[model samples]
Target: MEPRCHSWTHWADEVVLMSDTTSRLLIEDARKALVRRLVSVCGQRDLIEAYVGWILGDKTKEFVDFEAAALASKLRISEPGRTYRDVAVLGFAEHLSPHLDTLYALRKGLDWMLGRRPFLPNREPDFEVDGIALLGMAVGILASGEWEKRKESEKWFIALLAETLRRSRFELWDRSLIYAAQLLITKESTAEREITPDLALALAAKGFISVKEDYERKALELIVNQPNYAEQQVDVVATRLAALNWLMRQVPTVLPNRAAPEDVINLLERVRDSLRRWCWEEKPRVRKAEAVPVKWEILNEYHVQDLLWVILAPIFPDLEDEENLPSLGHKHPRCDLGIPSLRLIIEVKFIYNGTSSEFSRIIEEVASDASLYLSNDSGYDKIIVFVWDNSRRIEQHGELRQGLKKLQGVREAIVVPRPGKMRA
Candidate 1:
């Protein structure tokens, strides 16, 4: 029996080792696939920089190569009139170079790009490319403190960037670059203001972009079907590489997990508090100098349910209202609000009077509802009861809540008083 026990322990250890080995092999295979794709699409300078950036972060040797290439290309341009497209090149070079010549070139390029200097008659701007070039130029100017001396130009540059971001139908690579640049600018701004809305919108936009598709799986599909990178456009190839680089950097990091049961309870409690505030603070009617004030009231449970739906729907994107439950014997019941993702059901209750019997009836009704709502087959595992006490029975709330919590499947019980001001 001791030998058998030892054999079982040895088998479990072997299984654990095999599992770890399999995970490592899968990760290594994925890394190799990404590297191969990067190698095949090394034609563009940005593509090369992206590949190097992924592998070495900021210490990549391609930065030196990129600087040399930029300087060489700038030297070949004989005519000052043709330097409009050099904005990105000069901007990047300015970031790298300490010399006065690179700064002069970036200024010239910015002038042409921003239309302070006239372009040659035939050079209609590709606004998408221009947007990307402007992003690079902004980085250079910010790095060099050029924006400190030219406040008006800085304003124009920011306006142009904003307009371009708003109007341009850029591909994924250009769009991502613009979004990332905007995020960085917002982060580094010194202005005293509320930046949460701006930051939230930017993050929401980034999340929307990243979650639109399984990019790694899509990249693998492209690799299998289109073996020849020569056939694809340079921009398309760069976009694919950029996406894979993003995937590689992001895949290892974990996002915040879904809302837990405790979090949902806390959120519902906040909602309950908000309802009380609304009841107490909201003016019942607008009084004219000579006219009588009109009356307003939360007349029924449906009104409370509707208000709760309005409050909770935005918080939980998949919140279902009036979701029907399967029949239990002769009675059919519907949950007021259901968050399927959290496996939570919220039932709204309204009391007409402050009578003890009415409060007792609420406890009984909630107890019965709990059994009907929660079952082995039902998807929902937790229930929250929100009671709006229109009769303003603040005294009975503790008893009501205690009674509700004693019932099976009831995770939270919130009892809010109707505003005493409404009695006037």
Candidate 2:
């Protein structure tokens, strides 16, 4: 019987290993297919060829020089056939080139272009109306890093991109382009909290799978089946490729190993368990002349929140404390702690005593907070309530937790008793 059990366990382990291998192979295949598609599309247009080369770091000096020469000729002749929009694309491509001379020329060209239509905050710029041009200029400015040189041309370009992202509708492809540029500039810190969900929705609308789930596979699909070679389609495909590459390098995979809502609940349970053994006694000690115990205690909701924040910060770098929720009607609600990346809000409750009245009030307060928070545009999808019951009412905890769980958006409720021997 022992031999048979060992054989069965070994067989299960092999099966699990094989499953993981298969999944990895599928992911690799999907990535390769996307790269192949991108390469094929890059051949269709010079602008895309240059832009993608810059994005993928496949730029060749010979090709950059040739592209630069062509753009310079167009600018010099003031090509009757070329509109200012075309000049913007040329400027974008020129910036992607490695030549210093081309960059200087491109700066002058941008100055002329801006003279035609200066940056006006209130008025919509022509580039904003033209998604391809907008992205072209934005990407060009970023690739050149001229904005760092304190150049007015690049500064204006940055301002334009920032305003475009701020003002554009989330549903529009323009917003996605500007958001992608923003991501490239900030390297995924500044705008991620606000734009990620909207970007996912936009990608979904384009028939790509949710960016939150299986983005690599869906992004491959979007690139391979890029319906047309129209300028707008090219811009969209290019933006998607750039965004995908950035995600692959800088962002963690949202796959089989990504943390889920359940993992957060488990973490909270661990936190609660750790708090059980908190301090030498009910209060923390200071090793002065002797081990002097301070009167510091988890006295209120803020105290509970601060303790939780210290424990959670090392784990979640993006954790926010006292994050304000959108105002609903006349009431302004604030979350005790929020993990933006997880879209999880944590509300800490401190019950002075585990009395029935106190428990009832917690239920009502949690319920009210839930309605306001979940219904807001704050982007949090779930809530976890952490309750510190100082009254040691372990009996009422089960009922209180159950009642809190029933509230909408309350993913889990944790009730932790004050450590034994701690003065209430």
Candidate 3:
């Protein structure tokens, strides 16, 4: 049997991936704010996942270890299947521009080989590519020409596949293509042009293909004639087709005499809206209860948010100052770990909850084994629970204030357990 890939996760180290200190600080504050808002809205504080998931449309772990390992082995050798190393080397192919050409290069090879379309790879060694399924998805969106439905399906497929990749870890997951196949049917509607012939010609000069037919041809050519090498590959190609089919149904809008660019774009959006509408109508909504995720991953503090920046920032000046760091801001931007860094972190509780003790214990554990915790971040500096009593009840419950005071490291812990309570 081939050896397994590394068992560690990129998210395991909290601070390494961030671009800079500002990004780290912003993420920290965003994390807390997200938690706080979640608590107030859902009657519980730890609902950040649900909130963000809703926005990201419930993307879950998609890639499996077996899939990674299989792909990894194939990566070292010249082959059809994409490997984990291939994906990593792509350096975030979907989002980054440099990776776009690499992604296209992979697609070209797969497209040519399967279609017998005569593509040469320049025959370089160690030149693995992005997952074909993923590239198909991008093509569905970017190259989708006259088919609105296909365009929509492509979007759905991409989102689903991206989510799958995000969740794939070291453990062997069910490496199935069922979900991948379903992406095409979910939302494909149609492809319509947004630019006038004049503006379109300009965009074309700028490398944007504005004509619907041109896009359709490109999208189709990518998937057409590729023999079903594997069920996974086949499904991906089918999914791409589904997105294209949706695009075919869409009615292209024509530009009126001297139509403004914005107007043309708006007209184009109508086509996209039509695509989504058709997709929604196509799916048979499951009335059954959602199968509870038995193994729902609970992202620890460090995995979800950077914890290394917490302790070391206090000791080492100029620790987290970099250009690309995402700030701790989600709903509201707060905290800057630059120039003036945070000496201590604080958490405020609306109702007197048991979380204060939990926070204290976690912090103390980290502080006790500073080297161990610092080496591999174990989430959070120290948990300090502060109770804000909006309703008059602090005096009614005398023990609340006393409990906050006893939590070890709390500087000025308070329990305004009264109606007219206001203290910072």
Q: Evaluated with TM-score, which candidate comes out highest?
A: 2
CA lDDT, every model vs. true structure? 0.53, 0.56, 0.29
Per-residue lDDT of candidate 1, residues 132-151 (tens digit): 45545554454333333445
The 10 consecutive residues of candidate 3 with the worst lDDT sum are 323-332
Best by lDDT: 2
After superposition, the stretches of candidate 3 with alpha carbons farther than 4 Å from their true spots are 1-80, 85-345, 352-379, 395-412, 418-424
Residue pairs in collision within model 2: none
The backbone clash count of each candidate, in order, is 0, 0, 50
Residue 1 in candidate 3 has what lDDT? 20
TM-score of 1: 0.39
**Candidate 2 accuracy as TM-score:** 0.47
Provide the TM-score for each candidate, comma-separated.
0.39, 0.47, 0.19
Candidate ranking under lDDT, highest first, comes to 2, 1, 3
Q: Report clash pairs, candidate 1.
A: none
For each of the candidates, the C-alpha root-mean-square deviation to the true structure, in angstroms, is: 23.2, 16.6, 25.5
By TM-score, the candidates rank as: 2, 1, 3
lDDT of 3 by residue, 1-424 (tens): 2233322222222222223576445434433332333222222211122112111111111211222222232243256564323332232221112212343333333333233211135743221122333332332233222232434444444555545445443121112221222222242222112112222222222122324444433333333323332432222322332323222222122322322323322422243233232222222355557633232121233221232344334433322222111111111112212211112223334443335464345345433323221111111122233333434454433555454445544433433332221221
* Reference-based lDDT, residue 262, model 1: 72
Whole-model lDDT for model 3 versus the true structure? 0.29
